[model samples]
Target: MTKQYSLKHIRNFSIIAHIDHGKSTIADRLLELTKTVAERDMQEQLLDDMDLERERGITIKAHPVTMAYEAKDGQTYQINFIDTPGHVDFSYEVSRSLSACEGALLVVDAAQGVQAQTLANVHLAIDRDLEIVPVLNKIDLPAADPESVRQQIEEVVGIDASGAIACSAKTGVGIADILERIVTNMPPPKEPEDDLLRALIFDSHYDNYQGVMVYVRVMSGEVRKGSLIKMMATNKNYEVQEVGIFTPSEKPTDSLKPGEVGYLIANIKNTQDIKIGDTVTSQKNPAPLPLPGFKHISPVVFAGIYPVDSSDFEALRDALAKLQLNDSALHIEQESSMALGFGYRCGFLGLLHLEIVFERLQREFDLDIISTAPSVVYKCLINDGQVVDIDSPAHYPDPSTIESIEEPWVVCHVMIPSEFLGTIMNLCMDKRGSLEKTDTLSMDRLLLTYKLPLNEIITDFNDKLKSMTRGYGSFDYEFDNYRESDIIKLEIKVNDEPVDAFSCLVHRSKAEAKGRSICAKLKEVIPRQLFKIPIQAAIGGKIIGRETINALSKNVTAKCYGGDISRKRKLWEKQKKGKKRMKEIGKVSIPQNAFMEVLKTD
Candidate 1:
């Protein structure tokens, strides 16, 4: 029989660190050390279940698993480990995971030392007042220096690392010491008052066979199968069909009490009914107040996602619906474009989130997609004194509307080696980033703070920073505020008609260069027709840049037998007339790949 432990013996914690800092590997080691999974069935990155996540070597989602560990003090304890994604795109998910836990394992690489994301996650954990256990990973590597990293963590992260655990998840060294620290150092879940049931839903997903599966950290209640549960945020009730805990896989349990982490299935057909950070309680005896931090999340980045083949529109919609069941960060709305036809404009937290959603659609749903250039929400003040929020170029009003445009700005924190300071500063200035301050951590490392336009960093900022620094730089940012900027609506005209889908908002200084680049790329991608097709980038009625696709010459007299010289004229006139007719009626079909090329700025 499975050992049942009281709330005081249960320790709920999450693993947080920088990207590629061995969070998943450490979680895998914990699973093995506790014998949660048989050694014969163990695999690398065992907690990263998604193929995309494994292939990319990043944890894209947060996963929770339960393990029974015997402490050094000889008490059998139940430990719930919530593995969170380290990317800034999924930081909201990480916040939810941290809110559900009482402690966190702060993993840092022995060689790489502290990174940007490490500090970001550390601030989040500290905000939640969670007990932090510092761990230095990858001690088996030749460049590993645990003592130096411990000092860095203490000085930079402002955490006491004297008792930090050093371990190599790859070689299974010091695994037992880490487990013993978890058992003895990390505090257990705090006891709740004797009140009605209330469980916090940190994560949820739609299961095809079982309906809505909600992952809950029971706070003050016990729930079981057939219990009538209500979501406080939505105020909707459902009969609990099943309840279980993840032993890597869902295992049914009789009931989940306080301090336990598990999944509960409620017969919910609509995925919109359950949201992350919601409070689940008993209908018969509800709590007086709902749990804190239950609020709707809003998306910052927006893009239009269209199926390459218009016939797959419904298929794409269905796929998005299913994906949204698990990722509530994605927001979608129905939209149409004259050039791209029908599609949904989707919003995300960041560029990484957008890329992951696109990959999932292609890989999991077998859908070929064309995504437009990502945009940030812009606040426009119109002549009528009404403020309009615009996320797509299709919705941009005419310039004659006499309005000012405001774009979102972010406070970016970049940590890099001090040697590349000049190069990074120059690059940031080119992107319109204004330096606010700089902090010197040591002789070799520095942290740069800048206020940058959100539009500047959405595309290839991170990639370029890595390229310039030789992959030693890391960054994190948060939305600061919207500021007024001199911006204009840039449009691409094919022949004489403007393509709505290719329109975008650009700053006054970059309007000419951006337009020239787009026109040049369009010239290369758009195929030459019978008549010369001119591609022009225009701001209002003035053309700023232009390119032309030369017409393919035809041998009009190749098939003619000699008669009078007038016969040649007649044939030439006929050919010219035909060409004119074709030019008038012929429409250029922009291939899906061509649209994708136009969106690739870097």
Candidate 2:
């Protein structure tokens, strides 16, 4: 028989940590100790069901599972684990996860110490006023220094770690102690009245058999099977077909009571009807007021997603529609590229999110897609006192109509070793980062804060940081505001015809070098034709950089070997004239792969 817990016995908490800090591994061990999954069914990262998630060793979606455990106090308590993505790109989802829980398991790596994401999540948990229980993971490793990490957490994170549980999720050692700490240290949900239905949709995903399945945390009343429920945000109603909890898998339940986390499936056909963070209530006895919802998150990075073959345009759109049902952060619109054909201009939280979405489109849907260079939305103020937001390069307005442009800026925090301070500062400066402040966290560690352009950090910033710091440096960033800058639209022309795929907004100072680099790369990718093709990078009417792809050489004199010298000269003259005429009229056809390669350059 399934065990039941009262409101006081239910502990809703989430695991928050840095990427690759064993959050998933710890979740697996928790399931084992609680016996939520049978020993025969045990596997690594059991909750990460997606193949791409396991292969990448990262959590792309937020998952909540309930487990019944008998603590050292001889009391059976129900625990709901909200597993979240560790990367900064999904911090908004992490925030949503926190709001659904009463406490958090602040997992830290014993060897890696406190990272940028660790600090960022800790602050978020604190802001939510959730009780935090610090846990030191990977204690079985040879390099594990639990005591050192504990002290660093105390100093940097401003949390008392003297009672932090030290254990290795890999070996399952000290697993029992961690569970005990969760029940003893973390506060349980308050007693909820069984009056009106007030459930929050924390996360959701689409089910082929069940349609849209919403993962909700019941705040009050109950959601029972065969009951009418209404989404307070969308004002859409549905007949609840079933309600269930995740024992790492969706197990059907009769009803989800107050202060419990579980799934609710209705006959809802449209994915647009369900909104994340919206409140779900019983239509019969609706709650007086809906729960506070989260702020609408906007995309930080914009890119054009075009199918390799134009025939798959509809398939790509359908795939994105299904994917967006699970990922609320993705934003998309219809876009047409001159070289790439019909496609969508998509916006993502960050570069990783963008890559993950594309990977899913290819692996899950089996569609070939080409993504243009990732760009940020620029706020353009025209000379006629009009403001416009440009998300795609193709939509960039004429430069003659613009007066000024404002680009998004971010406040970044970098935690690094003191010795590499000089190297990192110079690297940040090269990326247009301005140092705001610096602090000595410890004898060996330093924290540096900078105000940088969001565009600068979205592309390969973290990878470059790891490269310079030998993989020891960590950083987190948040949007600060938009700042006016000297920005210009960069357009690439092949044979005097503009290619929309090779257009972007760049700062005026770096336009020359960037244009030169782009033109040089085009010269390499664009195939040699019957005539020399001139590639030019132009801003407005002024050409900043240019390159020429030499035409294919022909042996015009080969057929005149036995003829006189005049015959050979005439053949050469005819070839030159023909080449000149072809150069004037020949249209450069950029292959799909060539457009993909050119965008990847620089």
Candidate 3:
């Protein structure tokens, strides 16, 4: 016999926290307490099923599961748990995931207290007006102090601290109490009249055999197999061939109703037909108002994406387009470069998002990619009274034609041990970061805020901060506004010819050192050919400094074999042919690391 519960008795919620803060572990413990999976079949962080995600110990995507738990009163209730990604890279995805939930479980590390990302995610939950159930996780660790963490959450987030739960998601202690709190505190979904069919698409993915699979939160609709549906956003209609609820691993039902979260399979061959924020309604009794949707996320970071093998251009385009179907945050367009061949101009939310996209392309699609340095969008006003938006160095307006240039800035928060405060402050100063304020989080810990140029954050700032702090510092930033600043245009010349592919704009004070370091790195990696190469950096037309790469030369008349004169002559002839091939290398123009080394300047 199997257990069954009505829609009114179900509670759909998501677990959110900072990275490595035990959100997934707590989810696993919840599953165990409810006997959702057999005890012998348990695994660590079970929701992170992807091999990459498991290795990294982070959840890259949102996953939903259903379980039935019996309370002390001898009544069974269905719980639909959603595990969301904890990094800022997936913040937009987290927002979309929250739309399918009535509340969220905010997990905080008892030993570490609240981190920058922890506060950021908690604020996001509050903005959505989702009921928050705070949990102090990792109570079994040696440094665990649940009382202090509870106080911090109350003071920082301005929430009631009386009902906070303390539990070791690892040892299963206090797990039952956490479950009881969920049933008592979290509100049930408000039932709709069911007079019209309406549902909000929160997430979606493509399947090779099943076409587009959309995950929706039913608001006022009842949908079943063999129903005709219309997408209000796209004005396209389709026949729903199958419908079922997500069982953490798979869909195992034939229909879904109001207050339920489930997946619907429509015979819409193209994945683009089903967008993340689109609305699905019955073709006969469509609702008057469209489902509440979020404004599309505009990318703040831009970069050039190229395949290591130029022949894979089409494959790369197809792969990115497919990824964009599932990820609305990824934006791509056709881009061409004489040096890089045909590629793409892709936009991302941040640096981590950029890295993840490149990694997925190489791992999932089996394609090799060469990405240029990531850059932020710059707002410029031309001398002709025209406003221009520049995302790439190629699109930067000529200095002579610009009236003023404004660069994006961010409000940055950094938390570190007090002993390393001086080192971090020096780093911030060197990167043009202006300190806003500093406060003590504990006796030996400090929280510092800075207003820094976005250009600095796009460089190696994150890695350098971690390295200087011995991996103990945590930081996050949000776009504040733009400020007017003095800027300089850096141009690189090869063999006394200006190379558009090696040009960039940087702050005036840092231009000289940046130029020298870039040229030095280029001289080391670019291979010599039949002719020597001259690398130079310039402000306008006059060269500042230069480095030369000597051409290769060798002796061809050294050896002969016993009566094998023809073979030796053939070998020498091949060497002459190699010299001709070397000519192509000399004309290659750009260094192998030219694009990457320039972007490394902090």
lDDT of each: 0.89, 0.87, 0.81
Candidate topping lDDT? 1
List where candidate 1 sits over 4 angstroms from the true fold.
Answer: 553-586
Per-residue lDDT tens digits of candidate 3, residues 14-126? 88787888888888889888988888888998888777777777787677787887877677877878677878767767777787788888888999987888777777788
RMSD of each candidate relative to the true structure: 3.0, 2.7, 6.5
Q: How close is candidate 3 to the true structure, as a TM-score?
A: 0.87
Clashing pairs in 3: none
Number of clashing pairs, model 1?
Answer: 0
Tens digits of per-residue lDDT for model 2, 1-602: 36668777888999888878899999999999899999999988888889988998889887888999888778899999988887788887788788889999999999888888888888889998999999999988899988888989898889899999888899988889878888888888876765788898888888888888998998888888898999988888899999999988899988898889999999777666777778898888888888874566788899889889999999999999989877767888998867788999898998889989999999999999888888898999988998999876666888888898999999899999999999999989888999999977777999898999988887778888999999999899888999999888888899999887888888888789989998998888888999888999999999999999988989988776585799988889999999999888888888766776777775
Which candidate do you rate higher for lDDT, 1 or 2? Answer: 1
Colliding residue pairs in candidate 2: none
Pairs that collide, model 1: none
Which residues of candidate 3, in runs, are more than 4 Å off? 1-8, 39-41, 252-254, 383-386, 484-488, 527-533, 542-545, 548-602
On a 0 to 1 TM-score scale, where does candidate 2 land against the true structure? 0.93
